[model samples]
Target: MGKAAERFVVEGLVEQTPAGPRLIGSRCRGCGTTYFPQKASCPNPACTDKAPVAALLPDQGTLYSYTVQRYQPPPLFRMDGWEPYLLGLVDMGDGLQVMGMLTGVKEQEVRIGMTLQLVTEPLYCDDDGTAVLTYKFTPAGTAL
Candidate 1:
């Protein structure tokens, strides 16, 4: 049988680059505000330009805050090996803060203001064996 194909959990949310995985977002040309998950228009009330262009967010950021998910997520969320995981809000500069699953570092070692890097890992496999991928943050300089 052929190897299982990999796919992102959500399309257009992240892109694989030569350097590494990068988040796909939108930036306002008028006020320079950035947003994740991409936006159709600028939501800033003070900015006049409503159009937003696609932007690749920084690959690294600092952990702004975090929490542990001790319980299983709702039915919509799926994981191959379910376990308690850490979730973090990372500050990616330009006033942009992104929330993503934290990996590599132990929950007890997690700390605010720790440097993190963007990475992709399989969350689960599909019925056909396709690997479902999701973005996650790891301690900067950690080998994947």
Candidate 2:
């Protein structure tokens, strides 16, 4: 068989660092605000500064909030085996909060103050046999 294709769900979102998988974001030089997906320009309209530098956020964070997605998401959002999944907003310190799926535990077991760590998991396989990966937050110390 040919080599299996491995790809990120969204390019430039996750990076393999010495510490572990960290989410990539942009920090504005003007307001010092950070954003995921790496914004090109600062969101603050008051500041005219155009410099936004890349930042790797901390992998471990606390669960700020969460909800269970019961319905199937539309196309382009690949959930191979659709089911209710837990999604949460994580506080990565420094005023940086990230929204991602929560794994490694049942939906009802999730709590507001639980500690979580970043992990890259397989979302789905493409027609070309490529494994599409996405970042998720699982209970700290759980194997990815």
Residue 36, model 1, lDDT: 98
- Which RMSD values do the candidates have, in order? 1.8, 2.3
Worst 10 residues of 2 by lDDT: 1-10
Q: List the residue pairs that clash in candidate 1.
A: none
Q: Each model's C-alpha lDDT?
A: 0.94, 0.87
- What TM-score, computed on C-alpha atoms, does each candidate reach? 0.96, 0.90
**Residue 134 displacement in candidate 2 (angstroms):** 0.4
lDDT per residue (tens digit) for residues 1-144 in model 1: 127699999899999988889999999988899999799999899999887999999999999999999999998999988999999999999999999999999988898999999999999999998999999999999936
Per-candidate clashes come to: 0, 0
Top candidate by lDDT: 1
Among all candidates shown, the one with the greatest TM-score: 1
